[model samples]
Target: MSRTIMLIPIGSGVGVTSVSLGMVRAMERHGVVVNFFKPIAQPKSGDTGPERSTTIIRNATNILPPEPFTMQYAENLISSNQTSDLLEEVVARFKTGTSEADVVVVEGLVPTIKHPFANELNYQIAKAIGAEMVFVTHPSNDSSQQLKERIEIAVSAFGGHKNTRIIGCIINKVGAPLDDQDRTRPDLTEMFEMPSSKTNTNLEVLQMFGKSPLRILGCIPWNPSLVAPRARDLAEHLDAIIINKGDMDTRRLQSVTFCARSIPNMVEHFKPGSMLVTSGDRSDVIVSACLASMNGVKIGCLLLTGNYRPEPQVMRLCERAMETTGLPIMMISTNTWQTSVRLQSFNMEIPTDDAERIELVQDYVAGHVDKHWIETLTQGSTLPRKLSPPAFRYHLTELARAVNRRIVLPEGDEPRTVKAASLCVQRGIATPILLGNPDKIQLVAEQQGVKLTEGVVIIDPVTVREKYVAPMVELRKGKGLTEVVAREQLQDNVVLGTMMLAQDEVDGLVSGAVHTTANTIRPPLQLIKTAPGANLVSSIFFMLLPDQVLVYGDCAINPDPNAEQLADIAIQSADSAAAFGIEPKVAMISYSTGSSGSGSDVEKVREATKIAQERRPDLIIDGPLQYDAAIMENVAKSKAPDSPVAGKATVFIFPDLNTGNTTYKAVQRSAELISIGPMLQGMRKPVNDLSRGALVDDIVYTIALTAIQASQQQ
Candidate 1:
């Protein structure tokens, strides 16, 4: 079942729409796929009227609609006592809105709007929709008694409603608490819910209300930024034409300044976040506004009224001054007085156009809202936490940034490599050391329309040859290498980049966008060598499928292995999966599950499973299992009922290269999967190989995985 919240206002001007939208954004930020619904909206007169809160919300959030209702329709139903029909309509619309999302936030009616008893009407709506109420009250200095009376009225109104529940209340726009009223909670709860037996006039209300059900969740302080109107918004509201639209979306107009006075005196009113309004023919004040903008004075905007255009020569001068600054200029057809009225009436809502205020609310809601309350709302949620392909790819960048290791790319002159390096640097995931001539790398970057920022470390392998010659000679002495031979070996960019990693100059090296996997891994095998206890250097492809990230091991290495080596590959693949945030549930896949079929292949997998299980006792591993039984829960139940890892395998260890290679390709070709690596494991230092046909994003993710591996080894 989805979590449904009904935001009911105690009175007007309580910022209900903002609070509701903020809740949606907050839930969305925490990975909840949330939807929105406004059951009742106040009547609107014409097409040119301001957008309803629901219309604004749907547009701003990029969530499409089932549009909200106008109160006139709901008013007719309620006036004729057709509450059942009204409630059913709301319920039907809400179901449509929630069909695909995790939580649906239903914005209900505000008090003192149409349907004078809308709070009571809201209770019926809530009961029909099965919503929990979160009552919102605007509190102030004298709000102690006012809040007390309102709470009693609401509790009494909704008390006998069987289907609805009061989840909580929020003390909104609180300047502070009253100094004289008893501020203790137990005493306040008593006043809010009185005894029924006595009479509930004081006791008349108590007759219905057993006890106040309000749990005060939070108190959000009054913030002017949250309610400030954008200069662009006001311009659009008045049908005012914009002369210069620069930075209008971000420039907030907190207060208005009518500059009908002289320049010297009007300049005194030119405070930050104040919009100056004057007749368009007033060139003196217009020039003053432009000069203020040029001098870094943040006057929100300049509004020219009375439909009078500036002289051609004066307009040219004003445009010239504005060109040096990004201040907004607008022209209004109305006189100063009427324009001022429009400004006062302009909606200070979280409109689709104002990204600045939306961002502010995202931050505010994150900080002030009760986190426990938010979590409680989602505690019974059915939203899947599956690592989807896009989500998985996005998360890889985050994990890579955690370590920020240096990763060298050997194919720097290749366009894909250069573009990928720029992306890695731009995302702060890794410091990519691109090995190529600086000139050629820049030429390739320019061709790709990507700039290789200073963050990309460009080094000519030829220039770095002298530094690596001695070190390479020492590392390869066991193979009868001389300084002359080492120089020739280091001439290859992949070799040079690998030598950098082996010498501790860089944390990892990723190559092979243009080279073969053998060519990429050869230098590392010869120089960096395998880890101490590891028997072989194996490679695993991080197959990013539609719903999850899976590991296909030994697909790029070890053509065929006996039981012991197969066990090691399985163990290593499991470790790799866990290192990258996937808990290893190893499936030693074969043509048969258990002893259902017998052959050399089946026996080899069964033995390998036993050996792998012995190696990592804590791991959930099972083997001699077919792919269907391993990955599908229903198949596993029928084929290998008791195996822990059977249905949930994230790491698949292939029995040999022929099976592994072909299966991964089939999966990729058929499903259009994004395979990130042939990420080599068990190296003393980190060195991963990429596919020759890898996209820019593919290379970026490989570099990230290499960096993460380097971090783990460190």
Candidate 2:
């Protein structure tokens, strides 16, 4: 059974949507398969576009949450006294989307002026879904005592927190308490949570509960970046005419600078992500903006007030700079002062296209949630957690960031490898040392619009090959002592990278974006070799199916094996699944299920299953089962009713490479799923190979897997 947590706002503007998303992210970081559900679409305010949270989730995550019922449909149901039907509808949608999830975070409706029954509907939905309530609120001008009372009232309305149904509270958009002497109004930009240094208000708010049963799970500090509006959002809000729609949809306005001063004084305010609001008549300020754009300052936009357009002469002169810099420019009818006033009341809703801001908000808020409380949600749960694709990807990056291993990418100058290296460094997943010519790598990075950040180390192969020649010659001397052959082999980047791994110069190696599997793995097998285990090297692909991640073994290695070797492969695959947080239920796949069929393949599979079970009694190993009985519950009941691993197998040990590789590719393409590997197992050091047709993300995740394997190596 899956657990459900519903986030309901106790007051207005508590940022319930963001808090819900954050909860999902926090759980995913802990490797839980979490799902998100918004019961009903929120009524769009003005021209702010689609329901904010729903749109963001749809665009930003691999999670395909069911589209929420329209507000009109919900209102009509309630007016006709069909509240029960409404609750049933919500429950059906929630169950349909979250059946395989470990935890489902349901976003409750925020009570608005026109939607007074929001709280009641939220309560009913919570009861219907058996959801634990997490009341969301923010600190206001009211004293801590008053805030405590409000929380108490809200908790009492939700059955007074006596039972586990009332999980806790989340205080959002928390910042410093206001001073009595300070009469300045809070800045409009201070709306959503920011990375504020001052958190006195958060402390006070967290302590206000004062031994109340309701736990304070999170105290998200104010972060202005979460609410930063895109340039196009501002333009649409102000009904501004487009001057130059350069990067408007992507550029975010972090701060606004009104050109109240002359060119010399106002020039200091020009900076990246700052919107310059100046009248069009001010040629001095406009030209200054252009100059800043030319100087590589990514000015958010140039918003001209008073319905004015720049003179044709000024436009002609600055057109080249604006066009080259892709600087957004807009014209608003309101004067400077009026525009500032309108900006103060700007909508804080997130646009669907602002994926960066949405992810930022989720991660930022997730950081502040109590880790202990989050851990408790996962502990002692009997149900197996189905690791979703997003959860797996997030876990890989998070784990890679913690280990921070150095991985060598042999095909560094390859475009995908270059981009993946940059992304890995930027995301703190790994320090990628790219092995290629520096000039060629730079050219590739530039062509791909990838900034090979400082963390990405590039080494010229010519300079490094000679150093590894002696070592390679020494390692292969027993086979044939020849420095000439060693030097020739070291010319291959994969061989050079494998030598580095063998020498402990790098923690891991990721290659094969441009090379064949044999070209990639042959050097590793020759130099790095197999681990100290009693068996041969094998490979597994983390097939990220729609519902969960399954491990398919020996897909990229071992053409065929006897019963004993197949048993060893099954053990290795099961252990691998367990290492990656997947519960191991090894299934030995064959053309027939159980004792019903007699054939050489079935007998081999049955004997292999017996050998595996005898070797590792702890793992749930079953065999001679067809693919359908291995995974389908009904088929398992009809075919192999007494088998422990019949219906729910996380690891499939194929009899041969042909079967494993074909099945993985077929499922991956037919289901449109992502397979993270071909991740080599049983290697002494972490040296993973990629597909020749691998995308940038595929290479990045493979790098992460290699880093994790390196860190976890005994």
Candidate 2 residue spans exceeding 4 A from truth:
1-4, 10-14, 25-40, 46-104, 116-133, 137-168, 171-216, 219-368, 378-384, 387-404, 412-431, 436-465, 560-565, 594-619, 692-697
The digit string of per-residue lDDT tens for model 2 on 40-120 reads: 888655744667677777676666787789899999999999999999999898888788777888899988888999999
For model 1, residues 101-139, the per-residue Cα lDDT tens digits are 767777777777445777777888887878888887665
C-alpha root-mean-square deviation, each candidate? 13.6, 7.3
Q: Give lDDT: candidate 2, residue 449.
A: 44
Per-residue lDDT of 156 in model 2: 81
Model 2 C-alpha lDDT versus the unseen true structure: 0.83
Q: Say which candidate scores most in TM-score.
A: 2
lDDT of 1: 0.76
Q: What's model 1's lDDT at 342? A: 61
In terms of lDDT, the poorest run of 10 residues in model 1 is 182-191
